[model samples]
Target chain A: MKDILTIIFRLTVACLLAGLVMGTVFIATDKAKKHNVHVNEQKVMLSLLGYSAKNPAPASVAMHEVYRYLVGEGEALAMGYLLPLRDGSFSFVTIDLAGGFVAQNPVTLAAEKAGEAEARTAAIAVALGADKPLRYADQTIVVTDGGKRTAYLLPGKFPGFKTFIGAILAIDPDFSILGLEIMEHEEDPGLGAEIDQEYFKNQFKGKPLETVKKLEVVKTPLPEEYLKALEAEKSGLGAAEVASIQKQYQDKDIYALTGATISSRSVTNGVKAMVKKFAYRLAILDRVLAEQHIATPF
Target chain B: MATDKTNLQLVVNGILNENPIFRLVLSMCPAVGISTTVMNGFMLGIAVLFVQVCSSCTIALFKNVIHPRIRIPTYTLTIATWVTVIDMVLAAYLPEAYAKMGIFIKLIVAFAIITMRLEMFASKESVNASFWDGIGMGLGFMFGMMALGFVRELLGMGTLLGYDVLGFKPLLFFVLPLAGFFCVGLMMAFFNYIEIVYKRAKRA
Candidate 1:
């Protein structure tokens, strides 16, 4: 009885000591942890925007000025605070350009509105079974400075990959492609990484929706006869006009990565789907801008 | 085993003969996990050194009063307390290192080396002896981690402690976990070869 009592006494003392020490440590470090997280979020945002500098600012003046200039200043939305998923594995942050506050943990907000968006897209796809079914998130933030409205979608996954792909599609409110940015990819470093280069992504820019649908990587250039046919259809063109117009239909001569043809095709198809879905919205945004008498450099 | 050996001998033993990874093979959980980079290995080593020395001394000082039946649990709680303290310190002052180490910092509690040394040596040894043993073992663990990290960073990333080395063109395969296993395995073999030669010389 005495031995058992002594064991219990020892265990109790050890447990109490351990709890007291751990509690003190947790209390001491809580503030620092929060500060580190804030700084890390800023760094991640800068990297996503393709800034490669190690420290964002010098040690002399305030760093907040730099952050404001780079990421823009506004009240951070409460809902934008990234929360750990139920499984405690991954977290996501959402930036709302239109609402002027970045919203974190958009997965929860997305889940809330998924039903309506799903129904609408499903109805549209079902009606046009001939056209491919493309899924797009609702409540995306559209950034508009003057006349141009640019919508930035969050990085999302495509089929046949375990990791998410980061892509940004910029459309000129008139349903024409202005630019495209693929920030990062994990497909195959050198081979698949080529998708981010201007040579590949530039094909989409300045292309209208109707003309973009016929885009394909062809080996042989289009014959002179096809050019003659296209030119003859639209007459009364000056020398400079003919040259510029002829340059527009030049083949989108994208060379596929040697062994990574599938990955290359995946990005190409992803671009097409994104353009097709946003074309109508781009037109609507253009109409809105025109009505407001905004002059945008498209 | 020489009782008359000086502090320098103890240091050498910690780094070579009594290496916590290759020789003793304790505290491998963090050794393997945080050994991908020199910075991570160095920080983890410091953290482990602090915990091992403090906990060993505490355990040795209180060895007389602790009941045998609940001794293991008592040692665990004591080690856990030290780990939490170290974790908090890292988070507060060394936030970058803490963020990089991430979940491994918390897992320091489960490192077998701390509890093993406490139960096997510290509980029966003098306070001074336990302290030195902790230092030696901690240094050994640190050295092993750093060695693994150096190879990985240099070969895999073509950088040493994040500095560009060999003109920055690196073999990507070395940065992955599989390369870590191979590097450590080859290093252990090299250590074993040295040990064999030393043992033969001593016998002669």
Candidate 2:
């Protein structure tokens, strides 16, 4: 009994000492780990938007101020007022008017510093004079180069095969996909986790949002048409033919990852769900303008 | 079991006479599991070397106080603590490497080779002897894993340390789990054959 008691006492002491040491290390490194995670997230978001800089500067997007955007006010053109990108100079952009929106939107000021909707709104009212009194939220982070609004990114997460996959999807001013970058996932690397691979995600690039509204996953080999379209895409002369092929397949289906059908479908479905919600919200904003017989919110 | 052994002898014993993988045939799971790539094998070997050295030295010092009745749990606690510390520190400092090896590093706690060394050698020997033994055993395992990883990666991916040595893949079967057993078996036989020839040459 005494021997047993002595053994137990020594083991307990050793464990206590070990526990104390581990706790100290954990506490020491906690803040750095959190900072790394946030930076990695921002880096992934920026990379998707074609901005690969380590710090990429900061951007603030004002979705609500965009909601009540003044039309033809001080060189501002509106949404759905089509301009075919105008070759080399997509000069008419949301980014230039961004200066005006930034001056008007207080919530955007707070969003530039931190996230979380309620916290930003409250902080903005306290920091800036709230004559408009902070109603629905409008926040943005728009990066511009030579007066052209290049791209925009939205970070989101949805159910993956065996985990919640977080990713940042980028779209253009014309609501076409700029890129898709997976940030985190826990799917089987051999099969389901190929979602991170460029071969799988490259399909999203340049796909119009109208096509993404009703995405489908086709479980089969790459269709010959797509293969032909890819070959045509490389040669500059086949541009019109490639566009016609795209029009044929556009909204039809995306190829499923080989042997990771569920995982492939998960990403497609999640993207569709998120894009459809954004589309619905845009319709509401457009309807509000249409009711007053306004042509465009540009 | 030589009492008046030199430091060199103690160290060489693990690699040549009593190899954990080939001679003793201990801790084969990780030997096969993580030896998928040379990179995987080398990294896991590095982690195991750290844990093995840490636990062995600590166990050697506490041998007297550690009763036989509770030695298992005591040794386990020692190994687990070191593994956790490495896991956390690597995650905080070297996140990319940690993200790759963290899961495998945690699995090191369940290795029989670590606890086996504590019980078989450290408990019965002087602290210095056990420390050298730990280092020797760790080096032996690391080299063995790297060898396995080299062969596996070469045949599996036509690569070495991720360098594409072969322009085309020779055998994809070598990358699978089943291929691990075949590689370990063939390598074990090859080592044993070398040993038999070496002994015969010495006797002659």
Which candidate has the top score in TM-score? 2
Candidate 1 on A121-222: residue-level lDDT in tens? 443344324243233443332433342333333233454232556665555445555556664466664566666654455555556666666555543443
For residues B18-78, write the lDDT of model 1, one tens digit per residue.
7888878776656665688888788778777888899999999999988888888888888
Query: Across residues B1-204, which tens digit of lDDT does each residue of candidate 2 receive?
Result: 524777789779877788888778789898877788888877877888889888889888888887788889888899999998888888788878877888789889989888999889888878888888888888778888888999999998899998889978999999988898899999999999998899999999
- lDDT score at residue A144, model 2, on the 0-100 scale: 52
**Candidate 1: how close is chain B to the reference, as a TM-score?**
0.86
**Residues A127-170, candidate 2, lDDT per residue (tens digit)?**
44544233432322333544455555556688998989887777
Residue A127 in candidate 1 has what lDDT?
34
Off by over 4 Å in 2: A1-15, A53-142, A146-148, A223-252, A279-298, B1-5
Cα error, candidate 2, residue B84 (Å): 2.1
Q: How many pairs of residues in model 2 come into backbone collision?
A: 11
* TM, every model: 0.50, 0.74
